[model samples]
Target chain A: MGGDFGPGITVPASLDCLRNNPDLKLILVGDSTILNQHLGENLSVFKDRLTVHHASQQVEMHESPSKALKNKKDSSMRVAINLVHEGLADACVSAGNTGALMATARFVLKMIPGIDRPGIISALPSVFGHTHVLDLGANVDCTAEHLYQFAVMGNELVKAVENIESPRVGLLNIGEEDVKGNEQVKTAAKLLENSSLNYIGYVEGNSLNAGNIKVDLIVCDGFVGNVALKSIEGAAKMISTLLKEDFSKNIFTKLAGLIAYPVLRSFKDRIDPRLYNGASFLGLKGLVIKSHGGADALAFKTAIEIAEIEVKQDVIRRISEQVEKSLTLSKSA
Target chain B: MGGDFGPGITVPASLDCLRNNPDLKLILVGDSTILNQHLGENLSVFKDRLTVHHASQQVEMHESPSKALKNKKDSSMRVAINLVHEGLADACVSAGNTGALMATARFVLKMIPGIDRPGIISALPSVFGHTHVLDLGANVDCTAEHLYQFAVMGNELVKAVENIESPRVGLLNIGEEDVKGNEQVKTAAKLLENSSLNYIGYVEGNSLNAGNIKVDLIVCDGFVGNVALKSIEGAAKMISTLLKEDFSKNIFTKLAGLIAYPVLRSFKDRIDPRLYNGASFLGLKGLVIKSHGGADALAFKTAIEIAEIEVKQDVIRRISEQVEKSLTLSKSA
Candidate 1:
């Protein structure tokens, strides 16, 4: 019903996730007839933990967010969120039309108090560990208030996910100077400074992948964040393509590639995008994870695992509590 | 005088460039006493073609652009740009403070008629060939009008430098849909539609490295452009670091790396960033190229070679003519 592979990937991923996660239960929202076809043989094994909810429609990948919101009320993505909104599910995850999923989720779940808009929070593989970046496509044109909120929420997320005592947050900009950046970024920096968060100043894109020592969270407007994320993906693809072309040039090179297989594979595992799958829609009242639409079974299973972690960590409550505290603090000040 | 390596890197690079390009002549603008130290041994061979002009000051890397522009009238960067502005040299190249160089160049040479601010245009290594991206930290907060101007100027740049007949120009955006970007990008699309360039609608950042079938010139505001470029560099660095770690894991891995050395070396040559050094400040009245500050002799020499190609193609004159034609077309229509 969602994603490029639809039930072909999700059904198997959900079953795999349930087996690995002892306390997890999944409610799959899609066309029941098609879902039944895929669940033909394995239905009895996961009958107790997995339930299928019938959703009449599906969100098309290319559909406009507004259009989908208006017409596709019964889409698998929307129905999945509805389950979370009704407290029937602990969290919701989708690998569907990103715009449609975000719009539908926002309309149903709403935003946490003192938060203006939800940010798309995701992690990228840095030099050593991982670096979480936010506002990935949620608030395209962000205000100072929105960026500060992202930082606060992102700080909490990193602490919970990475087990850091105090996560340092950095504002993304063109230069590291105090006077650099557009008006919005400059104003946001000032806001972060005045707040109680462990706010590091500006961080350039070149140093973003330097890893955990530099920063835990990097915040920016969704426009800049989206561009940075996609650029990272593009560069990785370019390098791998070059490496493959080189390792297969001739018979001698093929033999060398055979010898180097183990080491090359270890390198590949470190840089694999699947190692970091699933991006959270932060600031939402309900926890929701967005997997890549083209993800395979392993990647989608990773996305499900991410949702389980956030639900256990109570990410939504953590963000809500912090936002209310900051709002009151600002009022008193 | 401007670069991190000072005259040490620049002098050697300029000499190498002169030897390679038969028609190329150089005007070294820095302290004569220091410049002569590096040029002492090879002074007689290119004495007729290479000239030295003494300047009192050099702009530091982290100096404020406005402050440098206001106080440093006799700086080396300024003197070299003056030569181009006065038609003494066909083009000027600098490995100096980017902000100061942009401000000084704009103040002295001015923008071409019908263009607003100048854009920083440079090439990035892609799958099959190179991709030229523009506004790489020149004008951070751009309007719809500014983005359109960048597209017009960048279109001319790719045509002149790459010698393509009608290059496909794509407006950089977070998504490929018409309604995917901010208000400014949406408005710019309309302007591009009515213009005289081969506009290819919107392009996402992920598909940028997909080679020539899609786009030749990718245009965006300076803020997004700079972030995208730097993110690309960071990803490339991360992949290489991972590879090195894996290749040195054990003696077996070491042997494999040695056997695969030739293939890996060939691959590295194809994707080296040095091949795409030196960014052109497009839409200016005179040609000016900015090389990387930390560039070595080979990288800096490539920057000089970039300048030679643009000068021979008369990039400035081509842009001036296009601006005039487009200005009239808009008025008449």
Candidate 2:
């Protein structure tokens, strides 16, 4: 009902997640006939842990967010999110149109008190394991206040998910210098500096992947964050393409590639984007993870695992308390 | 008197350029003693083509752009730009502080007739040869009008430097849809659409390095452009580091790496950043190129070659004419 493959990908990914986690239960929200067809023969095997919540409609990948929000009231994405809001489900995961998912999530789940907007936070593969980045196309034109909120949410996510007591949060800017970025960034820096969070001042774009400077969370407006994330993806793609083309250019290189296959495979595994597939919609009242639309079964399973982790960690409650504390501190001051 | 290596890198790079292009003459502007020391006994060998123009001061790498413009009037960076202003040189190339160089160039040569601000354009290695992107940290807070000017300048640059009659100009955004980006980007897209330039609507960040979509020039605000460029550099660095670590994990992998050395070298050579070292300051009355601050002798020579090409192609004059024509057309409409 979502993503490129719809039930074809999600059904199998759900089964894999159930296999990996004994306590996990999944309610596939889509046309019951198709969901049951995919969940075939195994229906009786997993009947206790798996169920189908029939949805009347589906959202297209290219559909406008507002249009989907207005028309697709019974879409699988909407039904899944509704289950979360009704307290029937701990979290919702979707590999669907990003804009539509976000719009519907905002409309249905609403925002957490003291938070103005919902930010999409995702972990990117970095030198030291990985670093979490936020506001990845959630709100393109964000105010300084919105950016400060993003920093807070990103900080809490890392603290809860990664088990860090006090995560070092860095505001993404063009330069480390105090005078380097635009007015929005400068104001946001001031807000983060005064806050009680472990703010680490400014970090440049290169700091995102470089190991020299360690940062737990990188915060920026959605516009800059989206551009930076996509640029990294493009670079990784270009490097892989170039490597393949070079290795297959002739017979000699092909032999060398075959010899070096083990080392190359390990390298690819370390930097694989699929391993870091899930993106959380933070600042919302309920947990919702967005998997890559073109993700395979393994990648989508990763997204489901991320959702399970967040729910177990009570990420929503932690972020809500932090936002309330910061707001109260500012008001009293 | 600029960059990390100063005359040590620039002097040798200048000699290499002089050796390669017999018709080219270079004016080395810095402290006479240091310049002569680096020039060595070669001063007599290329005496006619290379000469030192003494400057009393040097702009430190960390100096503020405004401070450098005001207090360092006799700085080497300022004097070199002054030479271009007075028509003593066809173009100026510097491995100096970007802020100092851009500020001094703007102060001395000023902006072109119909352009509001100067943009920094550099070529990025893409699947289809290379793509030129502009406003790479020149104006962090740009208006819609400023973005339009960047498109015009970037368009003119590719036309002159790459010899493309009509470069496909793409406005960099988070999404390709008309309603997907911020207000400024949306307004700028309209301006580009109605203009005479070959505007190809909006392009996402992945389009920057992806080969599927062919774009000659990508235009965005300086803040976005700088972040995108640095993100690519960070990703490339991360991939290379991972490759190195993977190849040296064990004796078996090390042996395999040795066998694959030739293929790896060719891959590295194809994506080397040195080949695209120079970034032009477009929409200025005179030409100035900024080389990477940590560039080696070989990389510095590439910057000089870029400057030579721009001078020969009359990029400044072409940009000025294009700006004037666009302004006239908009006013009439």
Q: Please give the DockQ score of every candidate, comma-separated.
A: 0.70, 0.80
> True-contact fraction for model 2?
0.75
**Model 2, residue A166: displacement in angstroms?**
1.2
Give the best candidate by DockQ: 2
Residues forming the 10-long window of minimal summed lDDT in candidate 2 chain B: B324-333
Expressed as tens digits, the lDDT of each residue in B245-309 for candidate 1 is 78888898888889888888898888888888899998889999999998888889988999999
Per-residue CA lDDT of candidate 2, range B10-129, in tens? 999999999999889999999999999988898999989989999999999999999998899999999999999999999999989899999899989998876788888999988777
C-alpha RMSD for every candidate: 1.5, 1.1
**TM-score per candidate:** 0.98, 0.99
Task: Give lDDT: candidate 2, residue B315.
Answer: 90
Q: What are the clashing pairs of model 2? A: none
- Please give the TM-score for the first chain of candidate 2: 0.98
The parts of candidate 2 lying over 4 Å away from their true place are: none
Model 1 per-residue lDDT tens digits across residues A1-333: 788999999998988888887788889899999998887866778888888999999999999889999999888888999999999998988989998889898999998877888999988888857789999987779998889889999988888888888888899999889878999999999999998888888988865686325677899999999988888888888888878888888898899888888888888888778868899999889989999999988889989999988888888888788878985467567
| Model 1 stretches with alpha carbons more than 4 Å out | A211-213, B328-333
